[model samples]
Target: MSTFHPFPRLPIELRLRIWSLTAFPRMIHVKRQCVGDHGEFGLQYMATSTPCPPVVQVCQESRRYAPYRRAFTTGAEPRYIWVNFESDMICNDGSHDLLNLEPHQQDIQRLRLPIDDELAYDYITIHGDQEFKKFTNIKEIHIAVDLQFAGFSIEFLAATVNKCFNGFDNKVKFLDVGSGYMMDANQLRILSDWKNYYSFDTHGRANVDTFEGAIRFMRILDNILTLSEMHAIDDENAKIKQDQQFL
Candidate 1:
């Protein structure tokens, strides 16, 4: 009901600072959708549940200061969503092609992907690890998992991590949509150091539909993966020692 008409009279530096503050991080959901029909039916990059950056539509001054750029192009469509690679995260549902983002791979700093076996196989076995590695600036890799799924075995999860993210130095985290906690890979390793870490009788089964329960489910998976890696290393060392005995 009330408006500040004199706001424009404020200092230019102060006005710019206000606009800069509006540029916050966002979770952009990207998925492939069927566009066109009849003569031309194809999948294109679609930003679901995301709106264009407000600064881009506020005014000419704000638009000029906006950090977003149109990215994720294809042969049919050259432009898609406006993304701030520095602060905004691109969340993919594993249906879109990673190669479509090759042009801006170096600019993306944060990415979220689903922890699905088929998706992992596509990236590692079909597409090859080099394609995923093109996003050279990634600082964090968030793996979305569903705690309710019974098929998420430790061996499968470890294989996915090893095959897809073996040499990645970036932070790997696990997130469940139903949970409030986001567990870091490093913290999982540390927590697994305790005795009887595999015992989760207090937390119940992984299918418990609760926030705290979801976190406990994810922790169990992380602990198993950590132990599996340690065992693999021990086996490798034993083989090397046995070979040296013969020499």
Candidate 2:
């Protein structure tokens, strides 16, 4: 056969395995330049022999028509979706390559996001503002936010999260959010409503009483904090210890 095959004799099941890997990571950090008009860097970076463009072309043919065609003749021609870098703070590429398999909406279960405030804010600005109720299969969301830069009002944030997570798919097991004082009252109020969500606190800060009451928040006791900041809070903690001695 003179015609070149994108994947030679590889089992379709194996191909699916590879496809599943591309969908593997729920949290991705792509630099600003990571995405281009040609293709998202993630997809472009997939193991390829020739230049990037040909790789895509070959992959397109290899993937798109194969999976869905075998599944059912009625499906549409496969579209290659990518979670490319749309901006500085977000990884725009997620399941783009898997779409090449011509499957309907994909389902990814775990999301552990390790990002900065800029990206976190950017993510909230893009995806958080709305309810992601459709991603029903999503079971966990871990966000490491830089409270210094992430500008969120408490009530707004709490309400937003409640609206998104309070759905029927309460399978969400853990929510790790490390944010700061930059959050306004509106944001705090919103998060406080999620009193029942599990693993509410991995850090000691959740015990601090805010205007929102004893918040089942996610924070730590500054184990990761810099020495200077720890010293600042240490004085306050010392005063509390002294008061307890009198009692």
Candidate 3:
């Protein structure tokens, strides 16, 4: 492709807008690595899959437009990860300590974590509910289910959700990593109630044990949350219109 010689002559506002448009959401995987003997001083590092945003290195103007910031540092050295907290989703494999991210808790909006025995014990049973409150601005929590532990009871899952992410109006999604199927948390609650009321075996009836079954189950919960959100907006608009008519 030929370079446009007149590109630099464009208005500063237009140039900035173009740079802003280049910003896209990213999924950054973070895990703690044992850098010392006996895993004494573990350090969290970004996986090779996540690369630095190109806009940051393009030009000074583009760097200014990019929202990426250096975060999740160990403080022992200059090592850190470039994070676009507003749009990037941090995928933690239940290795890094959540306390390490407390500095930027309010800025991180999206997070994906594995839900298993380790997570349930650490975050729910051991730390209790207070540890999760650090993320004040969290909007979405993606809980990846570990299919290896097929005996996960609905009570345990619901308790984990309520204890770890309670009091927040964030969207919760459960992802079966083996099948890459995602389900809404509200739908899971409904399923739990239906199972209890009808005396159905939780594992046998849920049908999320197999890949094909998980995909079919996820389809039912896919747009349920989105449709509810649309109805909420319509109700708010109607209320506003009714009040305006009397003015």
Instruction: Choose the strongest candidate by TM-score.
Output: 3
lDDT of 2 by residue, 107-130 (tens): 433443433445444455456424
Q: Judge candidate 3 at residue 72 and give its lDDT.
A: 71
TM-score list, all predictions = 0.65, 0.33, 0.73
For model 2, state the Cα shift of residue 214 in Å. Answer: 7.0
What's the residue-level lDDT of 124 in candidate 1? 44
Question: Per-residue error at 220 for model 1, in Å?
Answer: 12
Over 4 Å off, model 2: 1-105, 129-134, 166-169, 172-247
Q: Which wins on TM-score, candidate 1 or candidate 2?
A: 1
Q: Compare candidates 1 and 3 on TM-score and give the better one.
A: 3
Write down the lDDT of every candidate, Cα atoms only. Answer: 0.62, 0.37, 0.64
Compared with the true structure, the alpha-carbon lDDT of candidate 1 equals: 0.62
User: Quick one: RMSD of model 1?
Assistant: 8.3
Write the residue-wise lDDT of candidate 1 on 60-115 in tens digits: 88777667777766545544787888899888754435444546678878988764
Q: Higher lDDT: candidate 1 or 3? A: 3
**Best of the candidates, lDDT:** 3
lDDT of 1 at 55: 79
